[model samples]
Target: MSMIFSWRRRRAGRGRAGKDEFPDMELSIPTHFRCPISLDLMKDPVTMCTGITYDRGSIEKWINAGNNTCPVTNQVLRSFDQIPNHAIRKMIQDWCVENKSYGIERIPTPRIPITPCDVSEICSRIEAAAQRQDAKKCLDLLKKMKNLAKESERNKRCIVQNGAGCALAACFELFASFSIEEYTDFLKEILSALTWTFPLGDKGKSKLGSAISLRCIALFLKGDDLSSRKHAVLVLKELISEDQDFVNSLMEIEGIVEALFQIVKVPICPTATKASLVVLYRMTLSENSEMITLKFVDMGLIPCILEILVDGDKSICEKALGILDSISSRDQGREGMYENALTMPLLIKKILRVSDMATRFVVSILWKLCMGENENAVVEAMQLGAFEKLLVVLQVGCGERTKSKVTELLKLMNLYKDELDCFASSARFKFLKRPN
Candidate 1:
């Protein structure tokens, strides 16, 4: 984001004042002389995957805005990355030099972008420092790697290949052997680095999946440092997303589930809370492990999930609802949810509140509850106005599975037709509308 501002100032003045300050050349400049995206003379021009050229700032902004298609081509981009168009940039610079009498400022040459080799060199240095037990040097290298990775997706892959995970694991092992008081801050720095470079690939995951790294990862879950805790959960979330085997490994750690439960309950960072829920959902993907479900209930995860369901952000809501759908498939989880007062209404509210993904989970949870022994969950659904919403959802539209779940709940609700006589025929639920 700061890059956008820096490019703007380097172009001329702030905002549209550059034009007013130098009005002589606006008409003389050919349309092709301007960036199609920014409508200003090219500065640091770069070509994108769509084979379209744009000023670096404008194309970057477009990608940052979550648009991965070319504005001109309207073609799906092969990659979101920008390649610097050095030839086009030279033409722009030469034109500016030719138009100096018209007050056009020749755009300065952009700094040479760091290459994969540069990141690899830094990693080599970090590894050398590690072999010598040079903690300061290794820490400095890790900081530089973090900055390089953050600069571009291309750099992230380069850093990963350079053994970032192995480097971080070495840092953890080094800190573990040191007197705790002396290396606590470096340990935090290493965890912070892990947080920033999450979702590492096979090479990195092989290193992070080691027993030492798992134990070290769990330590942050128990510590007092809020940032470290957030990093731990987010890193775990990324790991779980990539590999269910990693999720199984996490389940073996003594206090991992409890620690995750604690994170959801304590809620230091919103992202951490979402991440912990995401991890739980991922772990639940394993085969029918009744003990895991029982353990989740024992850690008091049900209320925490439901509480977060009420107030969590989109991703958090999606994950919390997903876990609820999974856990409610078991007897103990269903019993725990039934006991919580907010669980039903909030689950009902979540139907159309967050996303279709969440709506699917919500409907599935209701279906699980309704499928359980008799009308307790059904009666509760009626009390929460779920039947009306379900009917409306069925009437308008939803995914096939979601529609199936809604249909099942409606069938069960109709079984108690005598009890629902007043409720179903009444005008109370008539105002309900389907979600878009």
Candidate 2:
């Protein structure tokens, strides 16, 4: 008769005699779990053929649950499917297999195994090869560096997960080893490789792809070749247009707007909207006004922009306002696209009607905008019956210094100048007159 060993007893890996031969031996429950079908702890857990249990049901219940192991061999089983479909369980299991703690997860990649080589030493050799202009030697050293990068990436998967530091270091070494004319293709190839650019750890996975892509992009930009810079811009733009999750982070890239007009369509994500606007602002800031008016204003982006002004996120609201102010400041052929954007009367109307503090802040931003160019915003401020509110804020009894600033502003609106004396007579500067 086959001995019926309890799951715990099997995990204990004891002999049939149950005598403690190796008393202190510690056994690990395999990170790869077993199948319940064959009544065995899983050796190689496949989904259907050999179920790797995902959810480790209570061990006592799993063992007692009894229908465990490879049903094919009536023999007591060692392989069983890990059950349940919890994403965290597999993550934990993968972490264990990598010998990594949850706090530090590694992004995995396939690496060429080479003996432990000091990257710094390798970098020195690569640089020397490049200096000698020995193309063959340089190529050889580059291959070795690539191998080192691969190995480093593999090792980092369990440790750093995103391997951003390792990837950058490796890219830098490769960069040092090649002349621009000889290495442009090589850099392009590496950046294009889908396998090489991901982040290292589980936590880093979401941001890793963009981060690494940006690094490659930065390197490309530094190359003397304008064509290469253009190509790099294309790649980054493609990534932004496609990857919704990465939109916000991608917006943070420096000098990104250098390629803004190349994008024909807008990304659907709000972050992308904000990013695109930022790029637009930077590009047009110093350019001729026709570019701003013909490109952005004529394209009818103002409405979409106004919608962003109403957004609840404070930073986004502020950024939008700032961009609008930038537009207002541009020469723009001395044309009115800037006012076309602010549409002051419409905005002031919303400000008076909208109740959210954020909206009020947004209105305040519009007020500031009008205060500047001294025309479009002022006309709209006068038309919207904003004078009373402006006067009230300017007068005492509202809030803090903001009120004082508004009062000063009302003094400047000229439309209120004649009426100011009439208003001042009724309300005492008495609030200011009140004892401190």
Top-lDDT candidate index: 1
RMSD of 1: 8.4
The local distance difference test score of model 1 is 0.77
**Model 2 lDDT at residue 244:** 41
Model 1 Cα lDDT, one tens digit per residue, 50-71 = 7788887788778778987899
Q: Cα miss at 20, model 1 (Å)?
A: 17
TM-score, model 2 to reference: 0.37
Give Cα distance to truth, residue 59, candidate 2, Å. Answer: 30
Any runs in candidate 1 off by more than 4 Å, and if so which? 1-33, 45-109, 149-182, 422-436
Q: Go through the candidates in order and give the clash count of each.
A: 0, 43
> What Cα-based lDDT does every candidate model obtain?
0.77, 0.46
Candidate 2 deviates by what RMSD? 18.1
Worst 10 residues of 1 by lDDT: 1-10
Model 2, 1-436: lDDT tens per residue?
1213222222333555554333232334443443344444333233322433422323324445585543434445454433334443455457446643222234332222332345445545645654565545645655655545555433333222334334433443345344444666666543433234343233323333346546556566445555555445544434444444444454455544334432213333444444445445444444343455455565555555566555425555555555555555544422443445545544554443444443345345555565665665565566566666665443434446456556555656776545655666666654665456
Model 2 regions lying over 4 Å from their true place: 1-265, 284-295, 298-304, 310-315, 331-342, 345-379, 382-408, 417-436
